[model samples]
Target: MSLRFSLMGPVRAWRDEEEVGLGPRQQRAVLAALLLNNGIRLSNEQLIGMVWDEPTPSALMALRTYVYKIRKTLPELHLKSMDGGYTVRAEIVDDCRGEPLEGLRSAYFDAQRVRLGDYRLKVREDCLERELDVLELQKHVAAHPLRERPRALLMRALYLEGRQGEALDHFHRARALLNEELGLEPGPELREVHARILNGDLSAPRRPEQLLPDLVDFTGRAEEIAQALRTLPGTVGITGMRGSGKTALATRIGHLVKGRFPDGQIFVRGRDVAGELLRAVGVENPVGDRAALWREKARGKRFLVVVDDVQDAATVRDLATPGSAMILTSVRRMDELPGVTWLKTAGLAEREARDFFRKVLGPARVDAEPEQAGVLLERLSRLPGPIRVIGGRLSSRPHWTIGMVLQQMEREGKLAGVIPSDCVAMLAPLIAAEERLSDPERHMLMCFARQDAEVIDSQRAADLSGADPGEIEMVLESLAGVHLIEPLVLGRYRLPRFVRFYFRLRTPALTG
Candidate 1:
């Protein structure tokens, strides 16, 4: 029988048009909140606040009580605890239209819903909730930042993914996190385990990085790609979070627009564009003035040069010559550069991100667990870097299911190094730049990292940092100007998830 839940009416639950007992009003409200905001994670704090308009210290206890009652009422409901929060399955379709004026799921839940549908949402047949039952749990993990289980899980998960380097790096972070948060070294339990892993005593299966993830289904960036193509013969700066595919986009453009350039195309990281271009044109070390020589050689030629991960404006300043067209990719827009077209890259649409998973993991396998795949996408924030990394890891081990990967990720809290080095390197330069800000500005930025809310206005920032309300606006704008923070509508500001994590890592130091 089809299940129906209503928020517009008296918060009722029904099976095949017949009302199912949701226990009581409070219990029904909990179910209503969960199913209504499916796919989006709600922290325990948030769920407690949502279930009851005002909550006391016992709110969590009350929330759990209702969760149990609701589950007893309907065993089919899919509620999951993931990524330090809770998520509901999108399959629980929404028919309720209350104060928000909703026609589609996208209209109501913009933060969570990536694809649109009629009245019904989608879930998988095997996308069961709570795969790890309380009885099956041998040990209990707590919320302390230095908890051994969380760090161990992420390290183990990374090692299993054949990323031993990342697993080792995450251990250092956990150690530092413990010292920073609790002012103590890792407990004896954690230290002994670390010793074994460090000594190569832990069993780890390593795979070479030979498997190049092919992207047959490139998506969600057609307009940006076209903009890159159209603004040729000049520097087109592609700015995005680490995994938003700036390098991949540049590579794709180089392939597509190769014919336009008669001489050749060269990609470089630093001021070494001169050498790369010289090598591409098959010219062995010119006599004098490499910059002038490059310009003279490219004088009339429509050569293409792509500079990836440009940290500062000076890198482009050196490559700024008339001969060849330049394509620059970086975390910042590099807006100071003359004649530069800025293309800000955002994460792929939910549907596009899911399609990307299928492309890597194979359609049949992905379709076998579409709902879990969707959750996995949400967990990875739909970034190409993590998506590719996790997808390729699964490809290496075909026996691994989507549910298992997701469970591990959820347990790890973004998994310190589950993805490639791209995640680690993306913020290094920006973080260096952030160091130049005043103490107040640095503290204000740290406030964003510490909080869960993304959109913070001047008033909120002022309150968080205990600074003047007037000063908060100017500071936020300054951060935005440097591309360290993002400005949203209505004077709100947001820090990207990774950016927030980076600052949070430095938060202990920032305050100290």
Candidate 2:
């Protein structure tokens, strides 16, 4: 004889069309627990934990009694004890016609009721998807305004019915309700639906391939590239002063490893990193509670996300995924971000910078004026940004010699004019970094810059700034943390030449 069990309503069982007596409520709870894990073993402790909120000293004996009663009542259940646990072989039915475990009072049973209730609603949603029952979905959303799946289904139904405006309005209301109630915005699913209705794009979300074009004149960083590639499917944080070619190095690595991640390769450069990442992976206009949806999209996928010009650790935490890799470029080291392989970039080596100029200006042009080129490279501090700008200017004006270019740069008293129009934003990162400093920090930096020495120790810093030597050391360490200054042997520090120049130009009074 077969047994039919129902927990969707009051716990009951029928054996071959005859209703079986299931004894007391606690006994019924044991029977329900067994039925839930029909083919699995349930230890005495496991059974008690699932059936009672607080088990008494006699609960173990009580549980054993319940098992005996259940076996005697339903002989066909084949309940047997083995391996210090009980296992039952019985068929369980999911009948969702009524409330699950109705009339049950134990806390354990109440939690199961909620879980099964959610399962029932999910089944109903599966049915409604085929039926397109807008009214039913609306009621579900009204009752559980926080449930994103039901609301998304409603949005889709409304869009299919040509009620675009209504769908949009419903989304706005859902957003407002979620924000007001839970202090969260809607997740990716709802936002995607809203974007689709607004753009009339009912197609599947697009997988973004937004990596910026790799530098054609990309040069050097062979070791850095190898190190980054070795850390595949993990995070690599590249930190340096502004215009140190951090972005270029990260971009080069991104392109080199693009073939490994079949899911996609995404690039994020602006303030809206989370939203940009979501949209790149097909969640358009990702709103409230984006982290969960972003993780969902990233799970079980091999992708590459290159976040450029990051200012903080929190910006890329959600971008980390189990099966993907990330390359983050920032002006400051993100020490707070966990599990990152850090590489600090600096001005290119003389050999690499010369090779870069050769690639941009042609070997003949660079070779024709090797001496002048060396001098120009020295004057520019061999930083790739300025070198590239000068290379472009000379490339465009072939009549201009490296000597003439150097004279022009000298006459201008700054390389600001030689910088191409497009590359002018290079200073923005430095300015922003400077603006983030505290008054004390800025004042200390200016005082250090005003000193005549090329390198300063804590004593020099304290004497110049009139602060304690210990306190000045801490400030120097803080400055080094942001890559504004470089720490050397014997407690000495040297600010980068370009950074010194920048501070001198910005604060003329600090200059000699």
lDDT of 2 at 137: 86
Q: After superposition, how far is residue 209 of candidate 2 from its true place, in Å?
A: 0.9
Model 2 per-residue lDDT tens digits across residues 1-512? 33657777878987645789899998998988887787799888898988888889999999999999998998877889988789886544444467888766777778788998987776566555545678988888888888888888888888888888888989999999999999999999889888888889865334567788999999889888877765666799998877678989998988877865666789888777888888886777887878778888777566799999887678777668875789998887877888899998887899999999999888999999999999888756677877787788788898989999777645543433233344344345556678788766777776655452457687877887788888888888888888777889757987766565455444544332
After superposition, candidate 2 runs with Cα above 4 Å error: 1-202, 408-433, 439-452, 507-512
Clashing pairs in 2: 185-288
lDDT of each candidate versus the true structure: 0.62, 0.77
For model 1, residues 1-512, the per-residue Cα lDDT tens digits are: 33545544345566544677766666665665677675678888877766555578887888877776766777756566676567765233233233221222222243323332222221110011112222222122233344565456556555555667877786788788878887887777567656766777665322111112335666667788766755665678888755677788877766665654544566677656566666555556766666667676665445678888877786456656553568888876776788798888766888889888888778998999989988777655677766777787788888989998766544443443233253344344445566577777777767777674566688878877777877888888877765556778757877666455556656655566
Weakest 10 consecutive residues of candidate 2 by summed lDDT: 414-423
